[model samples]
Target chain A: MVSNIEWTTKEREVAQEIFDRAYERETGALVEEIRDKASLIAKLEDVWQLHDYLSAKRHNIDGKYDFRDAYLVFVFSQLVKEGWVELNELEDLSQDKLKKISALTRM
Target chain B: MVSNIEWTTKEREVAQEIFDRAYERETGALVEEIRDKASLIAKLEDVWQLHDYLSAKRHNIDGKYDFRDAYLVFVFSQLVKEGWVELNELEDLSQDKLKKISALTRM
Candidate 1:
């Protein structure tokens, strides 16, 4: 809902400058164009945090970081709500659980 | 909250197969090694949706997809909750907002 079609010249200029830098730096080339600063900032943070979170979780062996992390709770809830994971027989999964879900989703 | 520490061999074997594929395909190399099937499934779904969501958002131009998408509302709320984006002065920001936030975070 946030749009930047009404930005003042100074604001728009600054925003354009940033976009140019993104194109030059390729930091967020995929999400460079945005309607407003709020949404753009929001998307940037989402990518930034997601990249960090994924990198950290990818290495966790105990499942303590991704499974129990506060930030991922919403994502976990979404999956359980979607029936991707069993609710009634909730037991701690072994290291091999991922393979099953991947097959299911890939199918 | 879900864990699979008590899975039977049949169940664990099935799960292991799925993990092997992920390792083989590199679909989710970052968030592997969960303790249970349920948790692993949940984590995998998180990464899956997040990857889809980010790739889509990263390419959005008008900020329509990333800002207004229902899934990102939680993320947006998180940013606002964390005070990374201004709440009281909620206005549509230009692209420059990203550079500002990036500079702030990079510090």
Candidate 2:
């Protein structure tokens, strides 16, 4: 089992904001795709892709959101690697955590 | 494991038509749904729903489409029950299979 993250109140709020921003961006892009019409098979592909993405994101975000401090840095790094949460957005986090996240994203 | 379906060429053709029709109709409805834009959450819900539905249909149709004679009756019955196929459309199939399929659909 993974260890629980040690989170300060301010850090928790920042994490929440970062998570929300990433979600909003992801869903916003999906909505735009939905608005575009395509062939039936192509449309099915989009739906399936979106379904997979959202389902996966749901499972990933499910346990991570409740202030699991240990997982937060990795989570932020993952979001950063995907271009969702920038390092600047996570500036409020501790330098130690930010450095690790940055290193992981680079790798 | 299920038994192999005994299929005559005529019956196989009928099965193919039914399968194609069902696929076309199912995908048609989904495509229509795709064209209608909803809220982000609602759109995500639709995308997930479509994803799950298409995934299931693919698995179900995978082996069923091979004209396995034993499974054909049940397959047709299922399609009939779902309103994707009509009894008259399957008239080319043997009465033995048709009666069984019709009974299963009623059940």
Candidate 3:
């Protein structure tokens, strides 16, 4: 049976590094220039907030978890709307298919 | 004796409402138009992340907590640099002084 997760520990590290660098770049006087400010932040917040919520529920691994699953789906949907990431052109995604997409990122 | 925390449950509720409304308004196509996007999100992330961190450490209350404390101080420093909030003009603040400013927001 396939797992629901797709993102590996490696991808999480890369995302975290990219995210951290992005965060450092944004914190200073240059903050006004980043793109899709509110929505991006809100989406970032969604992921981070969910991480927070889940961590409290004891479901996270040191603030990072598998992303190619439900969380990644949620993130992909959010990013797609903002033009940060793309959605598949051929079909509208169902929850089940989204789940399958998530399975692509697992370890 | 004065407590270090100044934000009341009332303030937290108001802040939460403002924050939630702000959040809802930003989550869609309009996300790109928001100001100081990265810095604001980073700051928002800081607050929410702190809330998450603290809550996981068991210090948060229903996702909101007192803001006129260390967390608020940290947030204020972040915002002031972005021109979202102001720092006291006459005085160069010491950490102790910052703590006093925080005391002003307590219930």
Candidate 4:
């Protein structure tokens, strides 16, 4: 297991701010309109999920950007700029798929 | 603001199991190798960030996938199946972009 690097309180706060602002700018609405702050913070935590996987993969490389940081700076920023899809829609989609899969299993 | 639909405890547990198994199957290693459970849970929270945005966009569409669910089922599943790009590499790429942007700003 690669050693985990926890995001400092300051880092988390900053990242959250960036995420919120970008999200608002692109969608033209505040994040709180649909979800609460606690919920948003919870989701932001996933940014670190892939950190260990990436760190191990890039262990041999020099001067790498921290996985968590890169996700915020690049992938996420792009997602915000492009506008993100909604959670309810995604859940509905999942239900649909689950039903289809269930039907197939019963057949 | 669209009505928020929170994931139930059961839903969260089920989603995590699916995410973890899919991740391990594709990476040939468990997620715990690099990050802890708490961290992984945090990241998964983000699947909901775009929900409001997507619902508003697709509000008129009949029989559409929820953004969050679609992300898990389609986008995330594809990422796992395709062998996700290492987070570090994405970070490195981001750093390169940042450096270039910084340089341009300074010029």
Candidate 5:
């Protein structure tokens, strides 16, 4: 399933770099800070804003890192690693299948 | 900062339940499916859609779980666990501060 995506080698490299940068931080402190609901929401809002920004930005360089894509992969990889979403449900499904599933889930 | 938000105990409980349900799934499969750029973007789009749904839904019961908030916290927790965002920068910041930071990061 990992190989099915369209990430160029450069994009993967960029994602790796972003991943590494994130890894260097003390996540435990952040976890500790988010003990209450308000902080958690604030952080989520921040992430959402970032996601929106990345989604809107255009990349001009061919085979270059799309920061938005790289960031999503970075975050989504963590979601998988931390068990937030079901992998089996997502795997084996084609993009069309995923879209159908997404449509069904929409309110 | 965690305590600054408004999540009730019931909301926390709901988030935990959702977290547990997600944990029971095989996330590795989902991760494998998102290997390329298109698949990754698709998965992200799905997540964003879900996030939007949760954000829009309202909970009438007092102290009951707000699925949207619960889900955000669940996902945000994973983001912290996986080192995607810097905790220190977030921990001491007030919501206004965070908003400012978010604004700065926005394109």
Candidate 6:
């Protein structure tokens, strides 16, 4: 269920950069949301609400950043779908990988 | 080994209250810490530092709050050791439980 396309050394570096940038962009938004929520947490119960939110967000982001070569297509697709990555940023990747990521993003 | 002493209805209520209050106190401190750190988190990596801290704290607090009657003595000992629960607050438990918790806290 994963893409097994071969990647060159340059493609690997490009993929990693794209992934890091996407992670930084998305997590920056999450931290902003957390800062706002944390400031409003006046009660013990309100703290649990923030805890639950961060738990879920951490799980989602952890899954998204699974950077195994076999999973990069799926990862990139999710980043694109979430607006954390643009199509042109992935141009350094093989056309095969890009096509797969594009197809998955649409799905 | 755990305490097998039976809990009377009143004892159970007292136990729950002490446990909850201890939890509220400890987590209140944690929330305050998070608020301060979150305000100062200026970079993506700083957010991950908070993320790691929360993950570890959640694991620790979750383990401490298992709340089964069989495990309450051990739980109370930990609470006491951490200064979240005082010995006098546990007076409602049986002498056997109180003694065990008191002894464990010293360890």
Instruction: Go through the candidates in order and give each one's DockQ.
Output: 0.01, 0.27, 0.09, 0.01, 0.02, 0.39
Q: Report residue A36 deviation for candidate 6 (angstroms).
A: 2.9
lDDT of each: 0.34, 0.67, 0.41, 0.35, 0.38, 0.84
lDDT agreement of model 3 with the native: 0.41
The 10-residue segment with the lowest total lDDT in model 5 chain A: A57-66
Per-residue lDDT of A20 in model 6: 88
In the predicted model 3, the residue pairs found to clash are A5-A106, A6-A105, A6-A106, A7-A105, A7-A106, A36-B32, A68-A102, B6-B105, B6-B106
**Candidate 4 deviates by what RMSD?**
28.6
Which candidate do you rate higher for TM-score, 5 or 6?
Answer: 6
Fnat per candidate = 0.00, 0.25, 0.11, 0.00, 0.00, 0.34
What tens-digit string does per-residue lDDT give for candidate 5 at B14-90?
Answer: 54554444432323322232222212232334434433433332111112223454244434344334444443435
The global Cα lDDT (0 to 1) of model 2 is 0.67
Task: Give Cα distance to truth, residue A6, candidate 5, Å.
Answer: 4.3
**Candidate 2 residue-wise lDDT at A47:** 52
lDDT of 2 by residue, B1-107 (tens): 22444678878887788878887776666555544432222565665564465567556655555546667777778888878788998887788777778888988
lDDT at A31, model 2: 50
**How would you encode candidate 4's per-residue C-alpha lDDT over A1-107 as one tens digit per residue?**
11232445665565565555544443333222223222333322332333332233234221222236333333332343345422222232234332332333333
Expressed as tens digits, the lDDT of each residue in B29-64 for candidate 1 is 222311121132223344444545444534431242
| Model 6 CAPRI rating | acceptable
Tens-digit lDDT track of model 6 for A1-20: 55667778889899989888
TM-score evaluated only on chain B, model 5: 0.26
Query: What is the lDDT, from 0 to 100, of the residue A17 in candidate 2?
Result: 85
Off by more than 4 A, model 1? A1-46, A52-107, B1-41, B62-107
lDDT of 6 by residue, B11-54 (tens): 88889999999998998898788778778866657766776787
Clashing residue pairs in all predictions, respectively, total 25, 6, 9, 18, 12, 0
lDDT of 6 at A90: 92
Which of candidates 1 and 3 is the stronger one according to TM-score? Answer: 3
Best by lDDT: 6
List the candidates' TM-scores in order. 0.17, 0.68, 0.21, 0.18, 0.17, 0.70
- lDDT per residue for candidate 3 within B1-107, as digits (tens), equals 23454555655555455434433433432223222322344443443443354345333222333354446544444334433334453134454545554454341
Task: Compute the interface RMSD for candidate 6.
Answer: 2.0
DockQ-better candidate, 2 vs 5: 2
